[model samples]
Every structure is written in C-alpha cells, then in structure tokens.
Target: MHAWMSEASLDRADNRRKVPEWVSAQWRRPGARLLLVDSDGQVATDETGSGPAGVPTSGNYNAQLHTFLGLVDGIPWFTTEGPIIGPSASLRHLGAVTGGAALELTVGAVALTAWHRLEPHCSGCGARTRATAGGLTRRCPVCGRVQFPRTDPAVIVAVIDPDDRILLGRQSSWDPGRMSVLAGFVDAGESLEQAVHREVFEESGVRLREVRYFGSQPWPFPRSLMVGFVADSVSAELTIDRDEIEEAAWFTRADLAADLAEGRVIMPGKASIAHRLITAWQGRLLG
Candidate 1:
C-alpha cells in the first residue's frame, strides 16, 4: 500500500464536536478511551510498541485541552496530555508499526496536540486563546477572533529521466549515504504542479514534464500535508545546487541495488512517501 493507514477508518464527526452537550455525551459513553500525548510530541504505545496504548478515561485530565478525536469502530477516542503509561514513540516510529484506525487516531492526536501547544495565543491580537469546538479551534476572548489549525503543504516528487533512471539527492543536513527523492514546501501563490517543477529545478536544475499526483500522507511533525508526485525530467544533466542539495545523481535500477546492498546508500524508511515514490520507480521494494 502506498499509505499504510490512510483509509477512512475513523468517523471524524466535525459537526457533532461543535455541540457541547454531544461532546460531553461521547465522553461519558462506555468504551470511551483517552490517548496520552507527551510534551515531546510522542504518543503512548502498547507493550508490543506497534499499537496505541489508550487509558480507560478513568484518571484526572485537563478537560479543556481534551480534543475529541472521533469514533473508531463505534468507540469514541480523545487525546490529552497527561502521564504516559508505557513507552512513548514519535509518529515516524508509529507509522512504521501500526495501521488502520489506530494509525489515523495517532496521527490526529499528535497533530492536534502539537497545534494546541504551539498555538495557545492568538496570532492577530497577541491575546491568550482558549480551546473550543472540542479543541478544533481556539478563540481569543478579548479580540473575538477564532483561529483554526494550519497545515503547511509540501511537494515530494520521484523524478525519472528518459533512460528510466530515478533522480535522488542528498541534503547537506542528512546523514551520509542517506538519499531520497527531491521535495520542497509549496511557496505562496504556487500550485502543486508549479511547486513540483520549481523545487526540482531549484535543487537539482532539472526541468520536468508529465508531473502526476501519486498520493498524500499526513506528516504532523509540526503539521504538514505531504503531497507526493512522480515526474519525468527533460534531461539527466546534473547542475546540483550545493546549498540545498549537497550531491545529486541519476541511478539505474542496477546501480541503486548495488549501492543499497553494499550499505553505500541508505533509503528512507517504509513509513515515508519518499520511500514509496522511489520504490515505485525502482519497480520493487527496496527493503
């Protein structure tokens, strides 16, 4: 699967959350659960470390910050910060381990919790805002301004040339031998396709055509929607930008296999869309 847990497993009752009484009813419902989000932006994990470890909604918690996540298999789920019961892990690690509704819940919990922590004050009035709408929005009491959660859009593309070789680059900050497809944030006043073309040229100096949407993933490290794509480059000539891309090169399937086998090239993990994009071009799984 391109996205392991990106299906509609949870019913996000947006309208229901707007009603205070309905939200309270859900909280009192039997089988209601609470997932703990830590200060480090990590979620509590089960003993196996592959699934979420939700408490029985039995302990003390800051109800104001308790965000209603929605229902998974007819069970209500909410997220709030409290004592982590067991081991905690980041979304990157959780993505690699879980699937289905659990993955969706964890993603939502992390994203909403992080947003709540970061956006406790109003951007417009510099006044403290309170969480409302089941933590979906924050309202400034003094300014009467409501703030919504923000998600930054980014484009990640797997670029292929006429020879069927894939273009991969290494960022200056990345570890040695680690490489992935070209990606960048969507600039203001730019379309997704335009961002794809601009990012490829700005980083690797390769103009692309046949740009196609591949898939998308919710990367909530600090809230971002990763839009994935595949494109064909006009030429394979390298004009690497040393500032963004430390090194870039075209790789045939054979070359990639050899490098990976020898531990000379470290591909992204199975959790990221970058891995899916590269493997799609490679015509098989890399790991």
Candidate 2:
C-alpha cells in the first residue's frame, strides 16, 4: 500500500474520534523525543551537544520546541521541534546519529524537514522569520509573509506504442540496470499535458500524442507532486539524449515480466509514484 493511503486511512479514523487525551499526554512526557534541525541542513541527534549546564556533551538542545498534528491523506501526523540555527555547532555531529537518514532524526521526518529550513528568512524582505503555529509555517514579523512547504509538480509518463510496448529510460546516475519512466518538472506556464509532451520529446526525441492522465501521487522525498500519464508514441525512432539519459528503449509486456522476475532491471522503488504508474500499466497489459 502507498504511504499516503495508509496515512489517509489513519487520518479518517482519527476524525471520527475525539482528540485522544493520550495525544496531549505524550507532550507532557519528559522522555518523548523530538527531532531537531539546524541551519546547515543537518538534523540534531543524541551524539553531540553540550549538557544543560553548558558542559561539552552529545544530545539535542530541546528547549523552545513547537508542536502540531494534522492529516495528510487523513493520517494523524505531528511535528514537534525547534527552529534551525544555520551555524549551530551541534549540526557537525549529525553523522554520528542514526546512520545519516534524515527521516530518523526527528518527528517531522524528511517530508517536513527541507521546507522548514529552506525559507528561514523571508524571501520578500530578507528579514529573519520565525517558525510559528507549531512548525507548520514561517511568519515574517517584518513583511508579514507566511511561508509553507513548497512541492514541485512533475509529470511522469509511460509512452506506449501501437505494438503494446512501453518506453523506458535509464539515467546514468541510477544504480546498475535500473530503468524507469521519463519524468521532468513542469516548467512555469506549462500545463501537465504540455510538460508530458515536452519532456518526452526533449529527452527521447520521440513525439507523443493522445496523452491521458492516469493518476497522481504526493512524493514527499523533499516535496514533489508526481502527475502520472500514458501517451501514445507518434514516432518509432529512438533518439536518446546522452546528456540526460544514457539509454532509451521500448520493452514488450513479456520482457517487462521477465525483468521483474529476474530483477535484471530495477524499476522505481515502492515509495515513488513512478512505481505505482508502471505497476498499474503492467497489470493492465498482462491481465
């Protein structure tokens, strides 16, 4: 199941009940931990901090933290942490904590981490803004600009041919034998369909037509909205752009199934919308 769906179900269930007293009680518990973030884009952990008396130590400075709970896809989630200090000394020791997974550092995890640190100062007036409303937003006292999480909307399309083949691309940066759908961020002033057509043509040098929207997913790997689609290949020629993709090719349904079985070609991971789109398409064809 997708993380969003699981979280949504939890959220829907929470809505029917009263705000549990235990939820509030957890806030009062002393040992309940919070993930701390610093300005250098690092998370605070238990490995490096001064003791309460200012002695050299290894733990987070947990005072003055914020707290909030909300539903994403109806899941009950909470964030309780303090503002990030860019030059804080505590940030240097983050590697010693939790093996460098940012998600493990704090309650907000990876989804809420980047946005909170990205806009610490107001972009409009260049004045320092304060994290308010329990880390849900940043407010500029000087310019009164309220900032929230920014999610880049991107289109991921599976181009299909009249022969029932799907187009896939392999990027140089990916692990060995990994292939996935062509995807790109929706440029300013371009519609989703326009982006799908533009990116596919640009990367693969193949024109597309009859683009159809499949579905969408909220990819919170630092905030991205993935819009999935299926497009018809108008041309058969493969013109791969070496700069963007190492290889582009068409695969038949049988070939895809074999790849899945042998793990010869790694598809998109389960956390991503790309995986969902590709799996759904494969089911439609194989069924």
Candidate 3:
C-alpha cells in the first residue's frame, strides 16, 4: 500500500479552494470535529464544537481553521478543522468528545493550522500581516516580506557496514532492546548528506562512506521534514555516546528478522519515515 493510504488523505485541490459557504455556515453548527494538539513530542486528539469565537485571543484559545485533504473509504473529500490547542475557556462549550489516535493526524496538518494563525503579526516590525492567496502565505504590510509555512529539515539514517550489518542506536530513555536509526536536525550551512554523516559519527562513532539518499517523510510531530539515507560504515567498531545514545552496534539481517518475529524489537511508527527506511533495507537483504 502507498504510504499515505494509512492516514486520511488531504487533497491538494481542497486546500487551494476558498472555504465553501456551506462550511462557513457551519460556524454556528452544533457538532464538533476532530482536533489534535502536539506540544514537543506529546500528542493529544479530541473534539471541539466550533472554531474560535473571536479573532483577538491568547494562550491556547486561539484557533486557525484549516481545510485538509481527507478520504472516507476510498473516495476523496475535504476536511475543515481547527488548529491544535488545549481546552480553553472560550472553547469550553463544545461538549465532551473522545480523543483520537495520534498516528491518525499528520504534523503537516497541525503545523499549517498553527502557523497560519500565529504569523498574522509581522516578525520584523510587529505590523499586522495580511493573509493572501487563500491563506497559503502572509504579506507584511510594512516590510513587504512574504512568509510561508516553515519546514525544518532533519536527517534519519541507517548506517551499514562492509559486513552487511546495519547500525542501530538505543536512546537512554527508550525501552530496553529498542533500537532506531541515528537522527538529528540539519544545522544551518549543512547539506542533508553532511547532516547524515555528522549525526552517525557523533552518536555512534562510526565514519560513513557511500552515502546515498532515500525517501523523505513529513514528520509534523512539531514541524520536521525527515530525510532518510543509507551510509556505508568505514569502521565496524562501536562507540556509543552516553549523552545522546545509550547503546550502538551492528546487527545482521537475520538478527533483525528474528527480533521482529518475536516482537523483541519494535520498529518506529508506520507513519514515520524512519520505519520505511528500515523496511527498505530489510527488503534488499532478504532478497
């Protein structure tokens, strides 16, 4: 199956169009729709009655209504929902609704909603910016700076050795025996390839060669674009960085398959680009 089929599809066409009159008419609608919030890495999804009541609000009360590409069954449709935020005094009237699964919501969906609302005021001069192009961008009236949604690039890599073993690292806070690829945010003035090599060396003390790019995923946990790669390890010896990683080592395909079969090793989330990278490597080895 395609990577996006698991999550609700947010059609691009829907996002381009103006909010339909029928949807706006639902402003006074009684029922609420699904809303999800993410602070750091923690996620919470719940229902809210309607969009924010007024424009000028503070704390978690502010809301930016977004139209997302969505699907019901195999048919494509659009969804108009509020941004991610906790319960506020202004939104208390929505009545109680159950929380939804975290994986069901995409980071793109949440970040787009929040950025649209927070950027109304210009960063340069505090002058109020005007929304343009159907909420896709903001134009600063004073400085004339056009601002769009921000996406931070990150690198998540699987380090491979000449012995055909894959390098994995376990964070100090993660459960025992759980291992994942070394990852870090791409710093300014660095390419994705540079970030991959630096992160692997810093976390596991493994020098890499033959670095090749893999696919990317929209990891919106809080606005991250995950760039995946496979790098050849020049050294087989392991050196774990206690501050960032608790353990680092090379594992063979047989070992990984055994662990996966016994549920001893847990892969990253299916929604995560990391999982897809690992799965791709496994396929090649098994073949």
Candidate 4:
C-alpha cells in the first residue's frame, strides 16, 4: 500500500443506526474536543502549535456547519460546511499524507465536503437534498429520495513479460521518456480484473494474464480510489494508440537503472501506489 493510504487508528463507529447521542452532550464532557474544519478540511490551530488545539467552533459557525465525523478516541470530531476556516491547519493532497491519526480525519472530512459540493439535488427526482443522517446521507423531502456519497474506483497495473521485463508507457501530456504503469477508470458493470485487462490492452495493445492484486490508495484530489495490480503479458508487440499513449516499452531492471542513472526515465513519486508497486516488484525480481 502507498504510505498515504496506510491505516490510521480511528474508530468511526459507522454501524451506529443513529447519530451518537454524545454529539449533543459533548459540552458537558470536560475533556471532549470537537474538531472544526471548513470546506477544505483545514482545521484552525492555536497560533503557537501545528495541532488543531485552538479551533473555535462557535465564533463563526452554527449547527448547520456540523458534519459529524464519528468518534476519535472517544472524543467527538466535527467539520464545518463553509469555506476553509483554519490558518494553521495542514492540507493533505494527492500522494502526500503525513500519516498520523489526523490524516484519516482530514481525508474523511475532505471526502464529505466533496460529496456536499458535488451533489446538491436528489438523483431520483431532481429535488434539492438536505442532510438527514448527520450529513452521511442527503434526503429529499419532496420526492422521498435518499442520496449517498460516491467514491469512484479506478485500476492501475504493472505488466510484465516472459523474460521478467516490466512494461511501461508514456502519455502525450507527460515529459519525454517519463513512463509509468498503465491505468484507467473502471467502467460500469465491469469487474476490477476485467478493467485491468481492458485498460492495459486498450492503451498499449498488449494482452495480459495472471492479473494479481497488489495494493490500493485513496487519491482524494477530488475523489478516486486507485486499485493496484501486477500482470504478465502474453507477448511483447508494440501497437501504440497515439490518442491514448505516446510510447510504450519493455524494460529489464538494468534498462531501468541505466535510464534512471542517465535521467532518461523518471519514476512515479514516492507517495503513489505505482511507485510502491514497482519498487516491490523490482526488489523481488531484480537479479
């Protein structure tokens, strides 16, 4: 798994049929801390510290701002619905998450914010939706329709051939000779395994088999889950789809090392699952 997607120690208590009653009674709990964040998942902190120890939830927010982000270590956490409010909070972006308990909190907050931002109307009848399940659900009063947040799934794979060479490709938008594994969105009614084979073949014209699961990552730039895999190619024939891939190649470990040493090939960033998957395979397969 990519370091950013590693598990953080948080108990969201998602199975609770109703919002915790304690959310309404947190003020009486002497040690309770209600985390406050704006639409961007940024939390206000004490001017002196990096931690969100001084976030004020009352000065500029009300009940409407609340997005109950389940319990963390028995203390309640809440995210606000308006513009980003924190001056000192950290921002976790694609491929960059300094894992701590707070990273999960930030990801959860941001995912919810995206749900609220992107979906305002019920899909069933086009009625304006309102929060009903402590912001976990958006319900329509006019049509009795309910909506939930969406997390789009995608597949990313590294293809290998009989000689143990890795298959990598470059897209038109990338810098020259910069190559990474092939990836694409999983289409409707398609299994993940099917998506992997379909995407790899579609982009590079390579037949793949022995598709195996590698790892997963949450790329929440907007909202995407990157599923990783490693597969073996049935043959090594180049049929580049100029519209999709600019170039494709098979690389032995030495080929990769030479290009990397000469600054001809740039690997994916460390924060990505692609980098991790490639690194893992290189360590196990390299002579």
Q: Return the top candidate by TM-score.
A: 1
The residue pairs in collision within model 1 are none
**How close to the true structure is residue 217 of candidate 2, measured as C-alpha lDDT?**
66
Candidate 4 C-alpha error for residue 273, in Å: 1.5
Q: Candidates sorted by TM-score, descending order?
A: 1, 4, 2, 3
> C-alpha displacement of 267 in model 3, angstroms?
1.4
Q: What is the lDDT, from 0 to 100, of the residue 22 in candidate 1?
A: 84
lDDT of 2: 0.61
The candidate, 2 or 3, that scores higher on lDDT is 2
Error (Å) of candidate 1 at residue 205 is 0.6
Q: Candidate 1: where are CA atoms >4 Å away?
A: 1-7, 59-63, 284-287
Residue 191 of model 2, lDDT score: 98
In the order shown, the candidates' Cα RMSDs to the true structure are: 2.3, 8.5, 7.9, 3.8
Candidates in order, TM-scores: namely: 0.95, 0.70, 0.67, 0.82
lDDT for every model?
Answer: 0.87, 0.61, 0.59, 0.71
lDDT leaderboard ranking: 1, 4, 2, 3
Which segments of candidate 4 are over 4 A away from where they belong?
Answer: 1-8, 26-56, 59-63, 81-97, 175-177, 285-287
lDDT, candidate 3, at 195: 90
Better of 3 and 4 by lDDT: 4
Give residue 116's lDDT in candidate 3 (0 to 100): 61
Candidate 1: tens digits of C-alpha lDDT, residues 154-228: 999999898889999999899999999999999999999999999999999998868998889988878899999
- lDDT per residue (tens digit) for residues 10-125 in model 3: 33334433444433333323332333433333223333433222221212211134333232232222222444455321211211121122222334435655566556788888
Residue-by-residue lDDT tens digits, candidate 4, 39-87 = 5555555554344442433433233446666666776666654543435
